[model samples]
Target: MTFSLVARDSGTGAFGIVISSSSPAVASRCAHARAGVGVVASQNVTNPALGTLVLDALAGELDAEAALKAVLAQEKFPDYRQLTVVDANGSTAVHSGPNSLGVHTHLEGEAAVAAGNLLADESVIAELLGGYAGSTAKAFEDRLLDGLRAALAAGGEAGPVHSAGMLVVEDVPWPVTDLRVDHSDDPIGELAALWALWQPQKNDYRVRGVDPTRAPSYGVPGDQ
Candidate 1:
């Protein structure tokens, strides 16, 4: 019921995840990333807490493979969940449980991993990775979005997707980009539009967070 890609940008030291699903607000549960840490996509049976669990392990200095293994070691129902992790060093790891839904599969590429369950076919994973990898010249966020688009084009989930999202974390303590289309007939398209509107202002928001005096005006009523 879900498909996702998690990636680390070696050049910028950023991590991101792009995800979509037949379920509503899929990303809110599946996508997770932390600045200077790593990114995780926890879907399939959808143990949302696993995202945080993996991140915590990464924060504790575990690499991608170690972090994922540590989490699965403690998870009560590991067989029902699918997880992907990409660390700050561009190392990647993925686990698709034996109990995962129809046509499920996962793939690891340079600095990235793609995973899905209840997908239209196994090729979706390869297409997602290929799309992201082929767009190395693009912005990290755009590459992630491209991956999601490619997976959908190759054939997404077994059913129509209703929600989609992208999460990115850079040098700040919070996400630099977090865009979601909670429920839509064309969630990925809506998400892409939101990214277009947000891209130019992304750095501005980060500046506002770290130093308000140096930040630009909000362009609202109170400023002179």
Candidate 2:
């Protein structure tokens, strides 16, 4: 009961994953990415460990397809999982297991790949892939949001998607963007709004971590 996309930003070499699902906290278990490595999404009776395996292989310098193949080869029940990977170079790969739940399909485009199961229709993944391809957003996060919105517009999951999330990793070891809407009637929209509100502080959070001297002070009352 999930749909997701993994993409690499050509301009900045960032990796991002955007996902939504009928289940709650999908991102917590399905989406994974690492700075300067790659992005991976694992669903359809997800084994969560598979996501980490893909990222680990990518960090070892494997290409998108190679990483997925290596990880999937070890899966005891590969036929029950759906996975997608995008490497730092923008190469993409996807796997939809034979036993994936409900109507499931996937599509790939330059630097991006999308997959969905238990979808409203086959058109859902195509719309998400096309939307990301057509987006002009300078930021990977915005582009991902565009893709998720497109999926929703095209009749997202078979039921209401209660959780939505965006994950992005830039040059830093930590995620520059990691936002989730655990339970919402409109999780995708809520995720977008949260991104907007978080945009200005994205860099600030990083600065606080690596260079507190240059970090802006928190405006909250306790800092005085």
Candidate 3:
């Protein structure tokens, strides 16, 4: 029901995840990333907790493979979940439970990993990784968006995807880009548009968080 890509930007030390699914609000549950840490996508049975577990382990100095193994060691239903992780060093790990939903597959690429359950075919995962590889020169968020678009073109989910999300973390503790299109007819396109709109203001939002005194006006009603 879901297809996702987790990747690291070698040029910028950024981490990001792009996901789309037949399920509503898929990103809220399946994608997770922390600045200077790693990225994780937990799908299939969709245990949001696993995303945190993996990130926490990575934050605790575990490599991607070690972090995933640590989480699976405690995961009671490992056979029912599909997981992928990419660490700050661009190392990756993935696990697909034997009981994962139909036609599940996962693959690894340079500084990236991808997984999907109930997908149209293996082409979906291939295109996802391929897109990331081809678009390394693009902005981190745009590279992810291109991967999601390629997933759609390759075949996408077995069913119509209702939600899409992109999460990207850069030098800050917070996400540089976090966009979700829950229950949209065309979630990927909606997410792409949101990224475009957020591009100019991305830094400003971070500024507001890190230093309100240096932040600019909100450009809304009360500003004089």
89-162, model 1: which lDDT tens digit per residue?
A: 99999999999999999999999999999999999999999999888646899999999999999999989999
Q: What TM-score, computed on C-alpha atoms, does each candidate reach?
A: 0.98, 0.98, 0.97
TM-score of candidate 3 relative to the true fold: 0.97
For model 2, residues 1-224, the per-residue Cα lDDT tens digits are: 99999898888998899999999999999999999888999998999999999989998989999999999988999999999999888898999999999999999899899999999999999999888888998777888889999999999999889999999999999998999999998899899999999998998999998998888988999884
RMSD to truth, every model: 0.9, 0.9, 1.1
In the predicted model 2, the residue pairs found to clash are none
Candidate 3: tens digits of C-alpha lDDT, residues 7-116: 99998999999999998999999989999999999999989999999999999999999999999999999999999999989999999999999999999999999889
Off by over 4 Å in 2: none
Report clashes for each candidate as comma-separated counts: 0, 0, 0
The positional error of residue 65 in candidate 1, measured at the CA in angstroms, is: 1.1
